[model samples]
Target: MSTSDMQDANLQEALVTYEKLQDIEDDMDEVEVEILRQQDKLCKDIYAKRAEVITKIPQFWPLVIEQAPPDVDEYIQPSDSALLLNSLVNLTVERFELPQGDPRSVSIKWEFKENEYFENKVLEKKFWWRRARDGWAGLVSEPVDIKWKEGKDLTGGMLGLVQKVWEEEKAGKEGETEAAKKLKQLMEDTGLGGVSFFAWFGFRGRKISAEEDKEAFQKEQEHRQARKAGKETEEDAMDEDDDDSDDDEYEMEIFPTADDLAVCISEDLWPGAIKYFTNAQEQDDMSDIDFESDDEMDEDEPEGDAPANKKRKA
Candidate 1:
């Protein structure tokens, strides 16, 4: 055969190979669904066993949060730390949509004792795995209201104020108001409006029309398969610069870092609590060390306690 004939043959072979790869990817996605289902069942049983153990341990959740990596620790303001230490008793994360809905979704519940900070006995935040209009998918959640006591708001009222502004803007149909702008300024201010980690409960991410989002997702997937099969079409030629992944306009405001914080809690701190707790204890042990020999490491160590001077942040 001529050189041109060989080139055409090779191109056809490549297209066939690409089509095979797309089929394998689609099969993998199906397998992932079953894997998530199994994981959901396993986690439910594990969480039940953990619930009994964690409640007996004093300050278990707080210690885990305290020892979180610096990225997460930065969100825990001093007041937030104190509130968790005093009031937070039990924290649990579960695939709440079991038996029917998507198991990828999770609910994080915080069981708190009666405290001056908030009135509620329980605060739970549910995050759903949702796709936006542009087909990008992640965790999207509704805002959770935190009923603050008269003078004990850990968010410095920023979250509450943001919520109020969001409602007002939504009702008025006004584009953006002076109050929203001022609130943004206050949030930036150093003293008056420091946001707390607990404000993460009030996070509201993208949730436009569900049908449109799903349609876009389906369209994107079809286009992806076409591209993999070496087919060029209008969808492939569509403007790459077009972006629709921003949080829906219905959300007047957002906790900018909420997604990162949410993942940290659900994925890292919740799942790896035992590791974080052990690390916290090891940290406490290191502070009291007087290592005379290598064998001293395994010997009965002193009872590690929280720092005596760890006073409430005023």
Candidate 2:
């Protein structure tokens, strides 16, 4: 081969290798970006899970501990403790306890047999607690072997279970405290145990009675009716007063005879009465009192104008 051809071949090979390297670098950059995004998403999910578990642990622990069977009959004498302890031991297997430092880190295992349907189940829950400053914390947990049986009266069934646990704990077989026994008994006796644990823990609000709503509605209606009746009575009284005034006006009379209707020749009312009488007589064609004629232009037309006097031949 010629020297120039060999040189050209080497340059071409170098250019192709450089382009391949750039492509590989771009691919690596994309992969790294995607990996970072995935990591961020995973961390967020973990934090969320932890937060939920932490929030639930404190609330769940108290109820579970409270409802557990009692270990000793602290109320009864020392001799009776053995009897109660024996009864508890015969029915239940193990006792669950809240961890000392962080509640979220607690683990619980409960094993029980369902004699009604002849089934055995073991429930286990694992938790992890992450602490923060100012007493804040997060938790992550998983539950295993929790079952949803068919045809179960959910409320009644759960209450029954808690009641049974309470009984066992009361006998001291389930390793529950004396306080727990008391709480369990109280809840069961008050019919609160039949409620879902979440509801009992204040997750839900209590319902109001229909009677209360009806009573409130009736009160509002009565108030409205009373106001309406008062308005109607006021209107009726006003109408009655108006009718009385009309009757008084109808009974009043105005009578003016010709003598009483005579016009006095006083300056104050003379002009008005003269103008009125003149207009009236003119309109009625009564020209006997011919004040317009010079013959009747006397200084006084008597006190009031009357019928013309008849004069005999002079």
The model with the greatest lDDT is 1
- What TM-score do all the candidates reach, one by one? 0.72, 0.19
Instruction: Judge candidate 2 at residue 87 and give its lDDT.
Output: 22
Cα lDDT tens digits for candidate 2, 1-314? 89999999999788656655655665685586465444434555563554465454333322222222222111223322232222211111111222223222333333343422213354433334332221222333221222334543223343334334435534768455554455445545655422432111111011112344345445534544544444321111235554564343222111111111111211112223224434544544434434345355554467678745643222
Model 2 TM-score (2 dp)? 0.19
Which residue ranges in model 2 land beyond 4 Å of their true spot?
Answer: 1-104, 117-120, 132-135, 143-145, 153-194, 197-314
Q: What is candidate 2's local distance difference test score?
A: 0.34
Q: Report clash pairs, candidate 1.
A: none
Stretches of model 1 off by over 4 angstroms after superposition: 1-34, 169-172, 177-181, 188-194, 220-233, 236-254, 290-314
Q: Which ten residues in a row have the lowest lDDT in candidate 2?
A: 252-261
- The Cα error of candidate 2 at residue 89, in Å, is 8.0
Q: For residues 74-144, could you state the per-residue lDDT of candidate 1 as single tens digits?
A: 88788888888788888878777777766667888888999988899999888887765454667777677
lDDT of each: 0.72, 0.34
